[model samples]
Target: MSLTSVFNIAGTGMSAQSTRLNTISSNIANAETVSSSIDQTYRARHPVFATVFQNAQGGNNGSLFADKDQSGAGVQVMGIVEDQSSLMARYEPNHPAANEAGYVYYPNVNVVEEMADMISASRAFQTNVEMMNTAKQMMQRVLTLGQ
Candidate 1:
């Protein structure tokens, strides 16, 4: 793939990871949020991504044992989805959001999971940045060779 294409691919990766990190931050920020009902609870969100492929004619390998054709370009974000898992319920009778049964519902987000996701997303973003930087350096080196 061309150096420019490498930059594009890494850029997409960085963007995707940024979205992931944002979602995780939202989740963690709302981890302790209490709600009067299930419908009012904050939902955890995640970003979806898809691969961009080019036909073999353009240079895409499209093979089982090899890297796919990245020359065509990078990837794209499909969407962000909310996790639909069950929310947590706790018995806090004096709480403002407590139900008739003294149970208050909270978001299903777990602090531990959110922390892990944050770390993972941050690392992925850094990796993409490094990849882009490496690609830039390689391109600069190639120019020096020509001069």
Candidate 2:
């Protein structure tokens, strides 16, 4: 890949991670929310990812031939999806949203899990930024060679 491809790769990575973080944030924010009905309750969401790849040619031999060219450009967010897991149910007769049976339905979002996911997403994003900086430094060094 060319030096310029680095920027494209890093940019895509950052964008993908940003989307992941957004979903995580939403999940965390709604973690404590309670509802009277299952239909109205919030569920934790997660971002799906896909890798963008370039067709690489086959490796070079002795005969005239194109080398295998294949590499990932970066990651992409396929979509954000709600967790299909069951929602949390608690018995709280004093709660406003409790049902006739004194049961309250809460969002499936687990604050601890969401917080961990946020940390992971943030670290991945920071790593991508670091990769871009390294790529930038390398490019700068190459330009310095022209001096």
Candidate 3:
């Protein structure tokens, strides 16, 4: 891989991590939200990521389906998916948002897990930033090779 491609790889990594962090924050924010109906409850959201690959042989290896010619390029966020787990139902008859059966539905978001994911995403983003900065320094030093 070329030195310039490092920038693209790191940029994509940062972008993916940013998306992950956003979803984690959203999930954490809605962790305590309560609703009368299950449908109205906020569901924990998670981002889906996929690795992007590029064909090294001019984008194709002269075959209809070429896997050997592909190389890892960067990461990409595919989409956001909601948690399928059941929502927390509390028998809080005194709550304002309680249902007719005296049950309040809370979101499926787990604050502890969300916080851990946030920390991981933050570190990944910082790592990507460091990688980009290192690439920039390397490129700059190459310019001083003749001096």
Indicate the TM-score of model 1: 0.85
Name the runs in model 3 displaced over 4 angstroms. 56-69
Q: In model 1, which regions exceed 4 Å deviation?
A: 55-72
lDDT score at residue 57, model 2, on the 0-100 scale: 30
- Lowest-sum lDDT 10-residue window in model 1: 63-72
lDDT of 3 by residue, 43-67 (tens): 9999999988866325643445566
State residue 85's C-alpha deviation in candidate 1, in Å.
1.3
Off by over 4 Å in 2: 56-69
> Cα-based RMSD of the predictions, in order?
3.5, 3.8, 3.2
lDDT of 3 at 122: 100
Question: Candidate 3: deviation at residue 28, Å?
Answer: 1.0
Residues 1-147 of candidate 1 have per-residue lDDT tens digits of: 556878878888888888888888888888889987888889888888887665533655444534732344566789999999999899999998898999998888888988988888899889989998998899889999967
Lowest summed lDDT over 10 consecutive residues: which window, candidate 2? Answer: 56-65
lDDT string, candidate 2, 3-76, tens digits: 78788888999999899888888888888999888888998889999887754233232323224444776788
Order the candidate numbers by TM-score, best to worst.
3, 2, 1
